[model samples]
Target chain A: MNFSDIEILFVEDSMDDATLTIRALKKGGLANKLHHVKDGAEALDFLYCKGVYTGRSINDHLKVILLDLKMPKVSGMEVLEKVKSDPLFKSIPVVILTSSKEDPDIKRCYELGANSYIVKPVDSDNFFQAIKDLSFYWMISNQPPHHL
Target chain B: MKRILENFIPFLFVMLSAFLIAVFFLVLSNIKTLDETKNLVEETYTIINLNEDVLIDVISIESSIRGFLLVDSDSFLKPYENSIKNIESKLLLLKMVTEDRDTDGKADELQRLIILRIADTKNSIINHKQNNLTIEQKIKITLEGKKLSDKIKNVIQEINSRQLALLAQRKHDNIDSDTNLKLIVGVLILVILFLILVGFAILKIQQQKNKLTDELKKSNNLFSTLFEHNPACISLVRISDHKIIKVNNSFVDLLGYSSADEIIGKSENDLNLIVETSDVEAIAKLIQENQIVKNYEMQVRTKNGTLIWTSASIIMMEVENIPCVVSVSMDINAIKKSEEKLLAVNRELEAFSYSVSHDLRAPLRAIGGYATILIEDYKDVIDADGNGFLKSMLQSSKTMGNLIDDLLAFSRLGRSEMVVSEIDMNSLVKTVVFEQLKNDAEKIDIQILNLPSAIGQPTLIKQVWVNLISNAVKYSQHKPNQKIEISSFQKNGQTVYFIKDNGVGFDMQYYNKLFGVFQRLHSKEEFEGTGIGLAIVQKVISRHNGTVWAESKINEGSTFYFSLPKIKIKTK
Candidate 1:
């Protein structure tokens, strides 16, 4: 797979949550351009084009970055902070898709410049619907600044 | 010392008066002595004058005798006889002048000598008249008369000189007494001035004492009133002995004692008021550090041996120069009981919700997700019955997952801090209605009247509107013509907003269970619901310090009403 072709960088710690989300994105026919990282560290590695992701290109324009809050080694909050604070990556849209419907987490995610925050519903069908809608909105419906 | 001075002032006045009286008596006696000296000096002068007159009368008698002898005339004899009578009268007057004390008998001797001279004059006069005298005999008689007259003159001279000396001495004594009286008077004046100043000082001191006594009395009254009537139980414990020196009425009542006498002079340990020895030691340590222990909650035993919670504050102070600790305690039994119960319930709810949200939901999601995936990916491998079982598993998981989410949201309502502000009810309701009935706009007829602004937490109030509006739409879906009426009114200082709907309402008898968690009036087949929508509505409205109730009839309609305080309606 070409690293520059990746549009969605999905970061989540739970394998089950990741599989369900990826499968929903795949069902929406957007998985070919999407990439999944098991934890926040791998997401940063992919974004910075470091470690095993050294072949990845930093110049690639991404459609949306999906993040989860609790992860090993690093957190999605830190990943979001890094991406939003950097001038090169600041215009990229970030979405928080996590099981935590906690008010503080949602508030903090927005405060850290998350474009959208969605709680992953416990019902599979509803979760699938939420993932499909967000992917479609972020990838196709919402206009990227690069096109603008 | 002041008391002693107060007592001594009167005695000092008495002594001062006695001294003044004695000085007055001394002055009186000195004045008497001066008067007597003046009388003595006057008497001496008078005696001298009378003695001189006696001398002059004797001379007159001698002269008259000589004249008779020389002139041999009867006129001369008449003068001589007059001289003789005058001489006798003058002698009697001189004697009376010296009557009080005949110092040297000089007055009487002078009188006797004057009489002798007069008799001598008479003899001479007789001889002259008879013409029986020779020249030699006449000379001899004259000489004897001369001698006798000289002796009389000497006696008068001696008496006069002595009287003159006595007058001088008495004059000197008078001067001495005048000076002595002046000195005594000067000393008396000084003493009087000193006494006056002392009296003034004493009076000023007395006035200050009276003022201080009044102030002390007032302060004492204030202290006793505050100490006895203060609501907090207060006691003064001596530092050295740890004995309760004083306890107020509140303390007596708090300790279940009939009188203060039962508690006073008793230590906290003796009364068993300190339930834990560690608390006493901790307070002791705090006091040693001079720290003011404030609102330290502890358990203490009362007189009846019942333990009660109290928030006590202790401070070290001095009362009447004795080091003591003043402990003020408030009975917090009711607050403590409620606090404990609340904390326990909160802790259990938090733990339960946390596990439900973090633990139960993920596995339930996995079960449902896996079942769906199996049905989708391997439709042929799963037979009809197997697909049915998988479908049930998926359905049950979804239901359980929903139950957990609703439960978490309900518990979060209790745990979350609410930030209340002015809510624009009209705009808020319009938004919720649009969102809830956006797709059903063609079928549902909804009328919205103007709603007054209210004071509430915005998010929670939004949740209330969401739950009620959704419930209204859900229940009335079967009706061919659906209607929802949203309006507001002012009543009893509250802004009451209600949602009326024509729906398949439940019986009023089930109204008790209407707002309870997971309580569904209709079967799942008839109206699909998790039964948390109305409960959430009730919870949210109640959290806003408002009331929520519905009027309903079976197969007719239901109207849900909630009120909010109108105090902050004008708040921006």
Candidate 2:
């Protein structure tokens, strides 16, 4: 839940994709204090200090949130809107992870202040490389705002 | 007009007069001749002396003689003298009826002699002074009387013979009269028979004539009735030039013609009512084929020169044993205009779908590209939490890019031409799977089962095998012994290929939508896909006249089956 403490907050619904992503991040040397959650709702709870993440601070600066667009409860689009609308957490970059490249969704995500979008590859090696590239580019290179 | 009046005949009166005159003449002649001939024959058969006429005279005297014979009681003898005188007078009359030629002239002499003799016999009887004469005296007296009578009788016979000979001679000489009479009688009989036969024959002929006249009247009534009250426009068309021979009231009303006579004896071209240039040709063709056009549509010009669209069909028939066409027309113009309007609508829909696709995707590529750059170029300035957020944003943009790409691919598949050729599928599947496997540093065993070489579009069909086999390899990567088997067999004239893997499979319920463009059963964090792979597989198979399906269970592996028809597959 603490973004300053964690380098990667991987909000995903699948364990295998999460494992591969983490492995790619480590291989790319971008895996520092990587934290993972199962869904958008839990990611929101962790971010806004609600429910299980209530003990956490309200505005903890984070470098990147690798968000899967499709998730249970709150979706990535909803999470993106909440974060981008809040000045307290607006500077934290959110990257959309998805399988489809449907145009309307991409337009909507970008309009909602998503920093970037990435499609998961079907090729195992390319998928692994995509994770590596996503982690290295977003976590190791991207900048974030100071604490609120 | 002049000939029409001339053609009419009053045959009934002429026939009746001829018949009655002949009958009257025949009846008049036969009556006069039959009467004269019957009377003449009766008189020629009369007899003489002992004849019925003579006997009648004798009986008259008998009454007086009976009174005279009873004279002894009174004066009966006085009446006997009178009776003898009466009998002598009758004998004289009989003697006068002589057949001999000499006696005919001496009739008086003979009569005197017969009377004297009769008196002598009477005197002798009276002198004997008896009511009955003695037999010898009676015999001697009757003999004397008979002897004298015989002499007179011979003379009378000669006279009778002469008269008979004369009558027969006259009869022989009257042959000319007989012939003339027979001629008159035969003529009379023949005329009567002829008159009777004529009367009977004339009656039958009159009856037959009446029936024929009635039929003619009925036919004329029917013809005139149809000309006045028909639903269809009727026209008499002359065969030589197709001129209107005569037009009915219906034709005049329907065509807006002034009068039947005005339209009569004029060609169709003179009316100028036909719309199509080929109207005459169509009619000619119809005639050649002997076809009856029931409700055909064509244009026509009204009498006022207004163009009228009508469905006109024709029937060819005989009128007074002459060929002509009858046309029935109905209006139909609105439907043709609506059909033209609908054709325009379909073109608009096609243009709209394409324009929407083009305008939408241009901006997507830009948004996706810039996002990736920001995350890549400025990652170091970001904190861990900030970095995580940027990374997710970058992933989202790439996902968007994949979404766009998958959508485009799906649409492109719809119209892509599939050129089928002989495909070495064993090599094709091997190469595709091997390329995927080569990326992984770990060596995995993929046992390729029986593979086939078949005809298909190599590029598209290769995509099918590649997607299926690569997916198999990807899912089973974590297994202790990662293995995938590829095999093919023929069934019902089709080649069905199977790809089996020991990997994490899906539930059957989710499999239904698995081959749709963006229908994904697994989460993004597990199996990475745009969900268009199976869709491409399905499309390529269909292009080759094929089908794709799968069988799976959670925790167990899956087997993908794709079948392709072995026909000459034109992948278009």
Candidate 3:
């Protein structure tokens, strides 16, 4: 995926989190064509090109799956597991975006094959820097599983 | 030797001596009757001796008459007749003597001798007339007469001599008897003297005994007075009846009465010493057996209508050779009150611990929530150092949350009421392991093994499994396979629960901190934790009256073990 298709897929439960996440991604210069979902369930549906995201092709361009752990329904861990387990979307990097550092589910995410895990910092600059670091790794350095 | 004695009550000795003396006097009276029968036989023998003397005199007279008849002169005949008359009178006198003395056989033998003499005289006269010329014949007759007369004389003398010898023997026996009687009198006198001396000595000894008894009575009275005055309750009871034989002034005072006289004859049951009559099963026991109920507590009713709790130690005894029970007493109301106060203090301590756990969580949540809000709302404008500073601030919030959680876990240990039951450790671990896996939508390979059912509170016990299993997953977050094997079984009367985790292990030196509140070996940035998971696990196990410990080395995975009491609970 090139910089044009490297728009962020932010999956978070908190509305405040999604807004702050978008702002942080934009500040890192990696926010073009930002797509958002409220929970892990929606993130899965969109990644599989089903539900509201039907007919969408994840093959041409998905940059990163930014997921949150604690949500109303499907947790970020569930999304991570579902997406990483599928041949169609396992190549796409999934980063956990959670409010709880002690989520206890973080290890499960890593075990489920999430590409990266990050804790949402309450401080603005730390939150921004973490976003920047993940975007740089996925878009530039992390050469996505060499296209089949 | 030390004299083994009881309290010598005098009646036992007096009654024993009285029986012995009555048997001795009865034997002495039987010996005196046997001496009187021998004296009557001697008096009858003396009367036979007098009869024998009269018979001898009659035979002499008969010989004289035969001599006179041989003279053949008229004048001589007249004289002889007179002599015969005299002899007859003498004979009559002998007969009278024989009758008086009861010797008739001796008198008849004398008459037969006289009659034979008369017949011989007549035959001699005839022979003289017929043989006119026989001088020699006459001479021979005379000689024969002389011989006959001599024979008669010898017979009378022999009879007298025999009678005299017998009389002398009787006299000798009497003299010998007199000597023997003297010896008997001396012995009897000695015996009587000894008896008099003994009786006098006994009287003196009895007087001394009486004096000593009086002194002992005085000492016993003084001792009893001491007991009465000694400022403590004392009582004496007669064993035969369940009645108070004696009650001291102290006891009388305690019962609020003026004198022991009022309390005498009253028993424990009558005075209500055993306030609840039904509780006197021990009283029945005391009655059935000889027992000393020592250091027992009981409520006794007083004369003033109040009950007092008394602690007493009772003893079994024989007073005046009769068994009785005595007891020493003390009051114990203060100790009871203090015990109740101690229970109240424990309850207050429990309440304080509960409040401490509840108060800790609110501030912690606010700190964590607000910190995240700050980071999310203003992340765009922060500089590099500002970013690091914000991260540290978030670290501080996380640390506080962990502290709060750890404190809650520690306090919960005190509040969780124990509900002991049998729990299957194997099935339980499988379920917990699967929950850990499924709850996260993770495929982290897990392992479990040999588990056993243990007696413990299931809900609290599940916490132990959850915490240990979650700890394995968290620490092994960076490891591949993420294998966790859980096996528990019973051994040595305890159900041991174990979890082995292949994770970034810890130093054995810091193993002590594994189950402590807020004890953490890894930094929060390396492994996300509240630091209270194992602590909660430790607390849970301990509430079941168990223990939690871990063995690990740096870089080697940790193995955690715990044990629960192997109590078997009934299903029904």
Measured by lDDT, the strongest candidate is 1
Candidate 3 off by > 4 Å: A1-148, B1-29, B44-399, B415-431, B437-456, B472-504, B540-545, B563-572
Q: B1-572 in candidate 2: lDDT tens per residue?
A: 42332232234336445645654554454444444434323322332342233333233333333343333233544554565566555554455334322334645655565456556645655744665656576557556655665565565455456555655655564565556656766765776686687567667767877899999999989978976787656565767678878766866876778888768877878888776879768876886687577666677777998675566677777877888776655555466456557657644643443434433333443343344444555667766787677566656656765665666666666665677778887788778876777866266767777676778888788778778977887788778877778898899988899998889888898777989878888887898988889998998888777888899987689999999876464678
Model 2 ranges off by over 4 Å: A1-148, B1-144, B150-236, B246-262, B337-572
What interface RMSD, in Å and to 1 decimal, does model 2 have?
10.5
Residue B406, candidate 2: Cα error in Å is: 17
Q: What is the lDDT of residue A91 in candidate 2?
A: 80
lDDT of 2 by residue, A12-119 (tens): 876656765676677677677778899989988888878887887765556788888767798888888998998877888888886545434678989889878876
lDDT of 3 by residue, B1-572 (tens): 11121223244346535634643443343233224324423433443443344344434444444454455433434443454455566556555544533233544655566556546755765555566425576567667766665555555555445545655665666666566656656655676675576567667777877899999999999997898787656677766787887776767776667777777888877776667675456744764575666656666678777776666556667878877766655555456557558768756765554344333433443454455656666677777787677667777766664565456556656665687777877788778777876755364766666676788888888887888888888888788667777777777888777888788899887777777766789997898777778878877877777887888866668999999777676788
- The Cα error of candidate 3 at residue B212, in Å, is 22
How many backbone overlaps does candidate 1 show? 0
> Each model's TM-score?
0.50, 0.35, 0.41
Best by DockQ: 1
Winning model by TM-score: 1
The model with the greater lDDT, 2 or 3, is: 2
Grade the docking of candidate 3: incorrect
The candidate, 1 or 2, that scores higher on DockQ is: 1
User: What's model 2's TM-score?
Assistant: 0.35
Error of 1 at B209 (Å): 19
